[model samples]
Target chain A: MTMSEAIEGRAALALLERARAVVDPPLRTALDTLPGPLRRIALYHFGWEDADGAPADGGAGKAVRPALVLAAARALGGDPLTAVPAAVAVELAHNFTLLHDDVIDRDPTRRHRPTAWTVFGVADAVIAGDALFALALRILAEDPHPASAAAAGRLSACVIELCGGQQADCAFEGRGPREVSLAECVEMAIAKTGALLGCSCALGALYAGAEPERIAALDTFGREAGLAFQLIDDLIGIWGDPARTGKPAGADLVAHKKSLPVVAALRSGTPAGAELARLYRTPLTGADVRRAADAVERAGGRDWAQLQAADRMAGAVQELSRAVPDPAAAGDLLDLAEFVTRRSR
Target chain B: MTMSEAIEGRAALALLERARAVVDPPLRTALDTLPGPLRRIALYHFGWEDADGAPADGGAGKAVRPALVLAAARALGGDPLTAVPAAVAVELAHNFTLLHDDVIDRDPTRRHRPTAWTVFGVADAVIAGDALFALALRILAEDPHPASAAAAGRLSACVIELCGGQQADCAFEGRGPREVSLAECVEMAIAKTGALLGCSCALGALYAGAEPERIAALDTFGREAGLAFQLIDDLIGIWGDPARTGKPAGADLVAHKKSLPVVAALRSGTPAGAELARLYRTPLTGADVRRAADAVERAGGRDWAQLQAADRMAGAVQELSRAVPDPAAAGDLLDLAEFVTRRSR
Candidate 1:
């Protein structure tokens, strides 16, 4: 909202746009290798084509992960052009999770359109997701970069952690609100969201031929930033405007999603937290959704989430400084990180 | 059945047992890297543990794919022991497919026990399968062999093809019996069943440092043998004894599975084919299953599948000979190929 924040936002947008410009061609080429039926589904999922196989201009996403890959590489003194494959691979891997998660979650829409599973059926969507993941690894395998194998290893391991995180998220949905702890919820957030972001940065550092310690520092930086992003997103999920988030207010509350703040509230042990748990015990109606949101706020969930986001961003900046000592060199990475945590939608 | 056949069968069994001995330890080690929840599902899926997490001796399926990997390496004059990672990776990839296919097809059982999806629920099974796939690639990426990168590329591409084949198979389920062409069915079989078998051999050949042409030949060898195996398995699905197959007779017919033989029969353009189509249109009762089996036979589906299996075996031998000219050197590969096609279950 301030002048410097506005400048950082624009700078982050420009970086993301540049990443998509370099990453899209190779990403499309990799996807074109898929057989016809699978290709169609993947193209549709990426917003490049319609369900009827027509071309569409629907945006894929903000390309935040890819931007991080390029920015980290540049920050570490690598050619961003040479790391394009890493960027493409990271984007592909991120979208793979989106397709499968949409199916598992059974929510209808994504990227302001019907989810792939809704348009093409669950079986096709699942298979398309599998193919996307394979294509991601294939890109790394085929890359002639000296760091390709190591990047592949990190990416593959990150995917496993991502799956574990998703499995835990689903498992949490079946239990009572008070059954999940704040620590467990944070772990899930790191695994589900932070792992890939960390992987993206680590891959960039790998391509940059940085030292192992530097790579580890960049990974930590991205992970902390990713956690901050998730915290803000969770807050938005509860209080975000429908016009911006494209969902009803308190959508997570209505679905009884055990998001970070909701779990934090339930574990707070305040009277308001107990009231929120009672509301969560049944299917939430219109009035109950509002009541639950109020209880979460009154129990200090909102304040806790805001403070945690700021703390995580601070940790992220500290780690970034360790990896890239010069503030000027770290400017783009810092801009992108701040942009993600500041997003309202 | 005959003196030479009996010897070959026992030799193949011994080879499989040896493969399991070498491959299981590393496979278990790789799987052990999974988080506790995911490891439990994978262990149960592999028949290493009960659904309740107790260690059980429920045998994992015969290590046929791993045996082929080692046999292919040895056939090409490489030290099979050094190819253990390839063997472990191939087995992991094979099990990954098994887990996903069971979920997609909603099959209730595998290896004579309840399927993982049925026991752990669909979400956990899906996540477990994804983790297994990631672990498979991680093994290849971490291998220090000169050929590990090339092998990873081939394996990743093969996984994409496998997904394509599975997608085609699911699509066929919604069409009429007469609508799916025999050629389409055969292509699907090759993609679904033969592709991974070929990949397993190709990966071994890569690890062996074989020439590209030799690797291609070995891949073809495995694929042809795999097709023959599928054809024989399809025949058994309709006609094999219940005691041997662990299923009722005509199980595929009961489920209206448009397997290779059934598709061939439906496209035969004979009165018996028409009768079979009618039987397929409605749910088959006990007597109807018998009639459908008779119709497929009269339509020449049984003879066609048998002759095709033999022809495929011959093609497999030709390809194997191209890769491994000496009969003595090719013996193990031949034994495993024959064992698979000769299986009744």
Candidate 2:
């Protein structure tokens, strides 16, 4: 790895470690009394148990959001440990969306096992998602420190945006491929994904006693970084290898998802748009995924998506630079931004 | 009419007046942009329209929770108008549960109309309920006041309890009829139903700047009153005339619901319990409902539930007396509690 990549990896890992150490007791204690089926399913989704609720290791995702929270706290001159509840809140909210998104997207697999919908049914999954949504807010309430309500308020506001953005995203599906402008798509992604990330950062700064203006700056930084990460995610969904993505290459193409790149390609409205239009007309199978990917690539969909992702990453870096002029306070967080935007998995 | 009946009638009318004045704007604004089908079904469910979203009147139920909020605020020497958002919050939360509950129970009708699930499909209903739920929290956020987070937190915490109670209630349905105490059933109802009611009162006090201790006491009062009200509801569901109760008499008995009266009778485990078990073993029809009602009355379920309601009403009065202290503040608020426990519809 290059020098910057090595630094980014270490920062990401270190931030995650701190978040892990701080979260278990209070969060776990909240789930201790559930019935076996709910307990097991929830635990498995939490990556703490097998699908049946038995103790086992499987399908755990990287705690990237929480890492950003902790790193942001430290960057704002606060001890990361004190911001635990806020960190946990963002992570839980992230997972809450994932649970519902899987059901909405009709994705059967997540982390290699069946999605919560496949395993628990949509009814139970919706209930479980609501449960987690409540849990996230409750976790915010548990913070006894003075900054708690502000942190909770910010998180709650961001989640409202998340729901709105998700609703818009789902609405996009039935109406045909959304020809969202590059700017508009980025803004929607900011709501869909960046709002929580930025809240995490702002929450950390609030706990660290950062001034209001600086806290707002940290929020701005996290927002851009979050958008950059989502753009990169869109690219990976379409082109990343199976080993890294945990799905067939070009899964986005197969699903005909109105991902940023696909939207970009549709907006490009060239041979690529015509090919995408044709593919969109029929049911896509495994072979069709190959053709869709090839068509998008030849039609320049893949290239546009990648270039857009890189541009977002650059924009994020510029935003971060303005937000944290003190390189000393910003170094580690900047590293995190780079790592997230560059990740293959 | 008896003196008690007149008071209840007046209170019910007052509740509707207070509810429509506060609930309409926020509910309509949030739903204005949704697709026609979604908006229509949701509006119908909220009693804002017929199933077709056309303008209508007279379908709305008594807005008991919001009335409790306004009455509590007025009783506490505060402006009832100031508590409007809290009132809306409680009502929205109630509807949120109803939408989900109908889906979980697979019930086909509510308030003599096809249920939201029947009209919109379960998926749309779920999304619509979420839309309402988010709107509840958003209303709190939009208040431009200091207590938004605290109010949201209380509502959120109560939602968690409500979900757990619902899960337990659903789980109990499959377990064969067995002895369950009136007290235990009350606890379930409180968790399942009282949380929102209690929140209504507490939120009003909070908005009015009532002392924290007073707020806690008012919450207790509202909860006890809620229990009394639920017991009364259970009575209407199983024994009252269909003309008075709106739905067919003995509806809960037909559904084999574990209402307060049913639980009380079952715990007796005497002749009533045995008769209940036999009746429960057979699928209930319209004629069967009449039979079950007779057995329920003969088994003393109606009286047991009534006596329980009397005790809870007294307890709630005692709690409110302790909190408000001033007889003047207790004026219509006491009438509200009595109305909640005595109303047939």
Candidate 3:
């Protein structure tokens, strides 16, 4: 597909940039209110500071959810900027989940630095996350002035999905290979990851004056896209090169993570399944990663996962086609979709 | 107050009773979707289980915040049942904070059993808190119509206050006596503990079709009353009998927690204050608790706190007089205020 034909690609990026300005003030106000140490850490995590907490240009983070929110608003033919609450709300929601996920997963580095809980201590980090969670709701409460109750309620649903997804992800940590069915994993991904992304876009549409039907369709598209993205990400987590991953290669293999490929290999009940099972029983070290990766490859686990990701991508594309009637915004959305699933980052 | 009067005093309690019917089915539905082990842990934390994860009647809690919410609605002359969503939201919000607080404080017992994080890992408890946090918001989202936005926004504002208060409380941990003054500590308590209580009632009033002025008045009354309730709590934390506190005697002193009385004593700048400061400079053990308590007593800390609490109680009474015009509900509110501060619980 041509770049211009993607789902509001340029428009989504532009919308995200515009929404950033709107979200900045309340966020800064919140940061300002925080005591010196916590405020510094939080600002740094938001990509606003250097290691020493001095001010810096934008650090890291694509702000994808916020962008999708704005694009959804624009697709609804409304002032995307007017949906700033939804945009900021989604971004805050994203970071809050990320911080918690890091704590739960024990993956210390976030945006290539110490996680919030790691640097600030768990007590402070938890409060920081709660702070962001509150800020998100406050941002949403600002708009729909007369409809603040309903808007706030919408935020709760998103939080439930986001939090529930994280819970399910943690619960699945020690799952047996057979238990990690592609369908189950996809559903988990949707709950854990897609919920916020989908809800953000849907909320954007809602705030932008879209009908419920339109909002529902856009949400479907967003959910599908988010799920597909995660599936592809799981694939990368296992076999992707260290340079691309910004960490050691075969990290998931060494950890014996139940990614889609490994789970798929197990489900196939082929030669790869037996080998994968045997390999998992032993503690995986760096030396064993090659054999582990080979077991999945020989089992066609990699190919199957690739195929599954393709199917989800197709589903996402189909939803996008049906939801976005506006040519400009639709093109931008498509670009974002392609960029999100296809790129290394 | 009489037992029956205490039972009837809190308007929000009636709302909570009503909320039980409204929230039960939906809460169960959400719980059903969670994984088995997680569902059980979260259920236990919600008071649905005994320590062994077996079902028990102890799932019932005091429902204080919810009662406050309903009372505010009634004080506003609105139907208490109409505020059921707000009632459930505030109760859930209160519980969510408690779950996390237990983890951070490293306290083992909650409602006379091991805390959720103590039984389940910290990660599990964190996720469970997330579930409840989400649940609180989701409960509000059921307003079923867009016109409910005002109520949603009000709940969101309450949530922000809840978070901000928690932040202040956590920030207090490492602060020196000078960094957090007694007045500031009281202000923090008002924001942290009182705000949610006030918010509960205010939202209840909003939901009950009350005029904005009445809602505002009820909020002010609830805020002052909540602060009074917390001051009494601070007193109990340090001085209440072990049987009443369900904690070791002088638990606050053991933790070096800067309770209001302790802060007050430290600020007195008398011999007792100087003595207390010296003891505070040393790591506290159970032995030190006795010394600290003695020092506080000598400095007139206990008396000062009691007087301050009385001042807050009077302020609450004054606020209630101005906020609630209706004799019956206002009377109930006052009775409840007396019950909360006077009773050991």
Candidate 4:
């Protein structure tokens, strides 16, 4: 990576670390209110405790969403400290989705550890997820901030959209290989991934007491950035090194995941697209998985996804500019956005 | 039945019908905002549509929780009409729990039809339930009432307790028959069933602009009534007529459900309790279920549950009187509470 890219990455990491510093205490306090079994499961899911209820050093996620919340608030000239509860709520909400999504996807691992359901069982994981979500909302509800109610409404609405997105993702998995369209997949990705990010930013704007239009702009900025991040993440799912991503190469291909690029390839209507569809029709062998990846690349899915990611980043920057006119003010948000989209893993 | 009992039941039915009328429109409006698949599943779960998406008369639940909300509001000299949103929210939250609980328990049916999870698949049911909860919170967050924030906080906290209760219930199911104590079972019942009912009443009290103490009293009133209802329901699970309950007699016994009565019987320390434990060790045949039911009765489970139900009802009345001193104003709430506990099925 270039020097500037390295600087941006480090800056983003610092922002994330700062967010974690402020958010973790309140997040832990909220989670501690859960009754015994649910509390243990939640703590385990958050990497704060082991399955046996002992403390663990396993890291939670990168806190990207919480960083966005704080950055958006600061970009709008609001006190980041005042928005700490919103940041904590956003992180809690994001983790709640992770727990449920892991169960729904039957994903065995997350954040380099066994997923909560794998450790505690699906029932406990699901209930713990529900409790986390409730706790997230409770934080907002109990917050004395003037913007708390609006933030809660927006966040809750975004959660519904997130649910819809996940439901669509699951539904697409049961359909034929070519059945899911590129447009549908994009919508699902936005709902599943972008909505919460957008809400995080919007919540920051709300806490900042920004105008409605500014909040909307920040929401759009975060959403576009989130889409860019997802596109790149999906690309990594197909091509990243196992050492970097902690997964086999072309893991999405092996699972026949109708990710954005895969759907783009399937809908390309080229001969390579047809070949990819044929490979996707059956449980893929390792060789077939390699062929599927090659076919996706040959069908121009990789190029298309890369272009889409860049275009989304451009759109996100434009939205951020609208929300925060000064480049210096928008620097942290941009850094975080670029860091997410540029990550090798 | 005596003359006064018959009148009270009819009055409660009328109150429920009135609540359904006011609450259904907003509930439907809120649900209609859901995307296609989640909306279809939720509609089916609420008995507003068939699995095929056709309109059906399957009948949503009795609107008992919503009735409690409206009744509590009116009892506090508030306009019940103004509390319609709170009523809808309580109903949505109640159904959300039902959807998740059905999946967790793997129950095949609800409201005399296939449960949402059984009909729509577990993933869809789970997503639909999550959306319902988000929608419930969204309603409160959007409400302009002075008490909306407190109501939201109370509801969210109650949901956490409900999750804890459900987690405990599932854990108990995995243990030996004699391992779950009566106190633990009772606590689970309160958390699972009583909490939501209490929240319903508390929400109404909030919307009514009642003082915190009054709200607490209404919550306690609903919780006590809810426990009484659970005890009676558990008893019905074992001994009610199949024609009335739409299940085989001794259904809980056959399933070895660690319901309140079963736990009480298991903890009785009598020969009959030991016999019941032995019967619970293996899958029960028809005669075995009957024998288990008789064993529980001989171990004093039935009488214990019956007495507990009565005592809970008395406690409920005491709390209701504290919240609403005038008997005339409290009549609707009392009638509804009595109707629930007095139901044969």
What is every candidate's C-alpha DockQ against the true complex, given to 2 decimals? 0.86, 0.36, 0.49, 0.92
The estimated TM-scores of all candidates read 0.97, 0.89, 0.91, 0.97
The residue-by-residue lDDT of candidate 1 on B200-282, one tens digit each, is 88878888899999999999999999999999999999999999988898999999999988988999999999999999999
Residue-level lDDT tens digits of model 2 in A168-212: 676566666544565656667888888877888788888888889
Model 4 ranges off by over 4 Å: A283-290
What's candidate 4's DockQ score? 0.92
| lDDT (tens digit, per residue) of candidate 4 on B1-345 | 999899889999999999999899899999999999999999999999998999997499899999999999999999998889889988888899999999988988888899998888889899999999999999999999888899899999999999999999999989999999898999999999899889989888888999999999999998998899999999999999999988788888888898888888999999999999999999998788889999999999999999999999999999999999999999998998898888876
Candidate 2's clash total is 0
Docking class of 1: high
True contacts kept of 4: 0.94
* Lowest-sum lDDT 10-residue window in model 4 chain A: A51-60
Q: Give the CAPRI rating of model 4.
A: high
| Leading candidate by lDDT | 1
lDDT of 3 by residue, B231-333 (tens): 7888888889999767788888777788888888888878998898888878877778889899998998899888888898888787777777567768656
In candidate 2, what are the lDDT values of residues B1-345, reduced to their tens digit?
798779667866776576677766765676664444556656889777876667766465567788888888887888888788888777877888899889888989887788888886666677667656766765775666666667777888788778777766766776777745566567679978777778888888888888899889888888888888888888878767888777776788878898877776666667866787788888999777777677777778888888878888888888899879988778677877777777676
lDDT of 4 at A252: 85
| List of clashing residue pairs for candidate 2 | none
**Cα-based lDDT for every prediction:** 0.93, 0.75, 0.73, 0.92
Residue-level error in angstroms, candidate 3, position B54: 3.5
- What digit string (tens of lDDT, one per residue) describes model 3 on residues A212-240? 77778878878878777877887888878
lDDT of 1 at A158: 96
